[model samples]
Target: MSSNNTSQIAAASALGRLSPVANAPSLESIVAAATQLVPLLREQGQQTEINRRLSEEMSRRFEEAGFYRLMQPARYGGYEYGFTAMMDLISEIGRGCASSAWAAALGVIHNWLLALFPEQAQDDVWGPTPNALMCGSYAPVTMAEPTEGGWLIQGKWKFASNVDNSQWAVLGVQFPPAEKGAPPGAGFVVVPRREWTIEDDWFVAGQAGTGSKTVVIGKPSFVPAHRRLLFPEAASGKAPGTAVNTNPVYTIPFLAAMPVCLASPLLGAAQGAIDVFVDMCGSRVTRGGAGGGGNRLSGFSHVQSRLAGAAAAVDAARLVLDRDTSEVEHTVSAGNAISVDKRIRNRRGHAYSAKLCHGAIQDLFTTVGASGLTLDQPIQRIWRDGNMIAQHITLNWDAVSTMAGQQMLGLEPKGAY
Candidate 1:
């Protein structure tokens, strides 16, 4: 139900195989397009905030750039660019608008999860439309029981991101418990959009544009066994997706790459925050400390220090995110298991990056002053978005240090975050 890692399933057969995804085409083009479209997105961002959702134009631009297919497997007409490509693009999108990037990222990643469905389950959704979208809240459980050919799922799942735009959903359910100490049965059920209704439940703080609503599945619906994938199986190395998706990337653990996916956007948002703050420093006036400082705010020594600190934070964050992304691509291509120690290291690196974003935006926003609170001010939005991002499970600093400590001591972290 959480985010995931990139490909890495080693065996005698995988030793000789390379990454199935194309490599020559760097992510530069997509990132460039996202950067170029920022001003355009800003024009609509204000409206999206007012409307409490991402603007249609913003969605279309991302879709046209194939953002929606970033994670879906290749056999289903998806780019399957792996975590690197997705991280790069998401970072770029984040530069323009955090909420927009978060929504798109969720939609795309969830699609990849859907691609892991058993062939029969995959067919029901993608067979009708390869690009069919599925979203979920991933919080509550949807109960299911064995039936003739499948399990009947019944329960409500809340916080289904982008539900209004999806045609189907993947609901995590706790199946009937098995023997006491034996593994508990769990699965993700695929259900049609019409079979469930959306409730306007996302009325909280930041990332408001994500439209994270509640999914109401009143009664049990027959979910062909093929349409259900065991959650515990996925937690382990084995997954039904392997039968249909032969690529090693599909076999990669979901929680592993999740850090990369989420961290990249935070880095981007931080970079964007730095850019705005530096630009603001050049024109703004300081308080009564120095009367009529020459050439505006640029003359102050403290101003220089703040700029340096904020800029350094942004740079550090980008490096950590980029390094983790490369680590994913390289390790996956080589077909190696990312040891728990390595995962812990990555968690620490990524959490530090999140800290950079959180600190930089807050630090820089302070200098911008009272004017920065306006709705039109980019700083205000960046502050809100960055704070929201810091709360993501992947970036929780406490959890990162705890897991890292466990790893160093050779104890199972249990993926606590």
Candidate 2:
């Protein structure tokens, strides 16, 4: 065996001494738990961005609060909550710190993603540490070499959110065809931290605390066959891991509502901006105009309209998110396959919801004028983070809107659904 293989084996053996599994917490209690941390999250928000990573203390708090277990498999000590519940919890966190919430949201959703892998892959991750978190880069940018038992993979994966806090990584790789007539295939392979190294390249103006750096395997690493999960298997709503996991939550098609994980944080960040703007309106005074320096900014009808519009936008976005998420969960619970139409509709909802949230933040930011631009102010950060999130390909308005329009018009949707 190679040194890499030996290291993996020894690490796996050490981690195989599993910790005692705790019972899952109720959704209400977990949401309350997350709410209780908002004050602290805000307190640390600046430092989190300065460090370009979530504080270790905050990560520990999230772990203790069972935030990571919200959508995890019950057999592995997770709460097994659905997407709607996840939205509630993550949005609450985002209200305090968008970047931290982004990291936490990914941590929460990846538990659900990992459950879609094969049984041994799940076991390889959770058997040793049931509460272990995973970070992922889902673009298949590299190919893997076929070898004994599995494949040898080596590449750098970017935008691995919350990578600093994760014990494992789910990397997207393209597998070469097994035969001359076969075509190439794409899939994910789970690897332990021992097999890869982190690159400190996550500096950004928005969501900086997420630590979404690059994960590199400078040398080829062997991944066992059972650790792989193909894209089609995941999108089919009947993944291999579903056989053992058996939860309808796991059976929901990938891309149907997975983008909600990206949207929820923006929902909260927009709300947070509104919160700050509302407070500022009450105390801020107008200056250098006919209104003079003593005039209350909140007295202006235009300011009132901005607040109302922002509030309405947030409310509308939430309704769309709640409706689509409920429909997905209900359909899966009834053992019905999530239809392509519904999937595309959900995709539209995700992208549109993000747009609404981004617009709300932009409206509130305009009302705040110069005060909202300060680095110390949370509104500026929220505004910046919301803009960054809106730029994500999955949530981009132009791309998703066109794709949704095509699907609605009885044409083939040309984008990932």
Candidate 3:
């Protein structure tokens, strides 16, 4: 049998032994399912990059593993495990393939994002197909025209990740000002697949497997009022969907903890780099160096130090992610609003963790010598993916640090938290 079929059969056997409910697997069992896919993911990493998108079998595998439902409402056949659980699961997937993990991370987190929309929007998505997934573009680059019952949107939304697998899209657009002379407000409008077309425009040097193409609305599409969610409302603990979903997980601010999904995959990619580095070190020998031709790479002090530093950095990043995410979950569950200070701190944690992970991968990549430059080397791919992730607007170290520092110094923070 093919590896894909064999993997499916094995996953089925494991599920039969572990989870009684296929839709709502226990955290341990679900994580175990992700763990089992790691080898397959690693095996497919090259092909995934080559295709510039995740395979149908891979998407199906993730769905069967129940990874996408980690943060969805239980009423919608999800586990509602919250952000930390998502971080843990995505990080494990990252250890195998960062691009796949990136796509999967967004797939899972968008479920939580959808839960923050109005009840009608939620039902529109999951009421008919509970397993349906969504892709999103978060920059409000165009303004929506006020229509009779809702709004008419026409434009292209870039970087809609995992667009190939998604049945719906949450597009960012500016709504007309509530009052004359007021500035237009930014928010999201949920549109079904029929309303938009996917543009094949995601060619990039890193994270190519995410399939983050452009979503184009060639003609004006009418989105009902109930399908819209304003940014401010999402940033607040109480969103329109909160009344019905009522999960503390949905109450957490959008930018406060959502960036963790972006950082979690980098954390896993850094660890994966370390794993490949160590394995390479164990067998590699110097060919032509001042020291000697046959000396073992691992016996060198520089190699050992790089490994230690990289491991420490990865550990520190994981700690920051866990602490901040856990704190958010605890505060929201206790009925407390996520304070501004906490939000900025969490933002700092997200950026700093990405910095740490990128640094770790960079340190490891430098030690790999000329062989690491080859396309087949996983370390090179990890390094590129890490760099790409760190450069994301949400995780960019300089921007995030400046925002946090401004908040700390009693100046109004300038950017999204």
- TM-score-sorted candidate list, best first: 3, 2, 1
Those runs of model 2 whose alpha carbons end farther than 4 Å from true positions after fitting are 1-23, 179-181
lDDT by residue (tens digit), candidate 2, 226-335: 99999999899999989898878889888987898899999998888887888899989888576678889999898999999999999999989887887787678778
lDDT for residue 209 in candidate 3, whole number 0-100: 90
The lDDT ranking, best first, is 3, 2, 1
Q: How many backbone clashes are present in model 2?
A: 0
The numbered model that scores best in TM-score is: 3
Clashes of 3: 0
lDDT of 3: 0.89
The alpha-carbon deviation from the true structure for residue 318 of candidate 2, after best TM-score superposition, in angstroms, is: 0.7
Instruction: List model 1 lDDT by residue over 1-417, tens digit each.
Output: 323332332232232122255642335676677888776665565566566666666677777777787777776677666776677777777777777777778877887777677777777888788878777655437557778987777777877767777889888887776666764576678888878888777775676777777888788777777777776555443578778777666666666666666677677777777777777877787665434534466666776788889888888887776666556556655677666566667778888889988898888888777868888877788788789878877788877878888877888775632
Q: What lDDT is reached at residue 317 by model 1?
A: 81
Best by lDDT: 3
Query: What TM-score against the true fold does each predicted structure earn?
Result: 0.87, 0.93, 0.94
List per-candidate RMSD values in Å: 5.5, 10.2, 7.7
lDDT per residue as tens, model 3, 9-45: 4443232123223556677888789889887888788
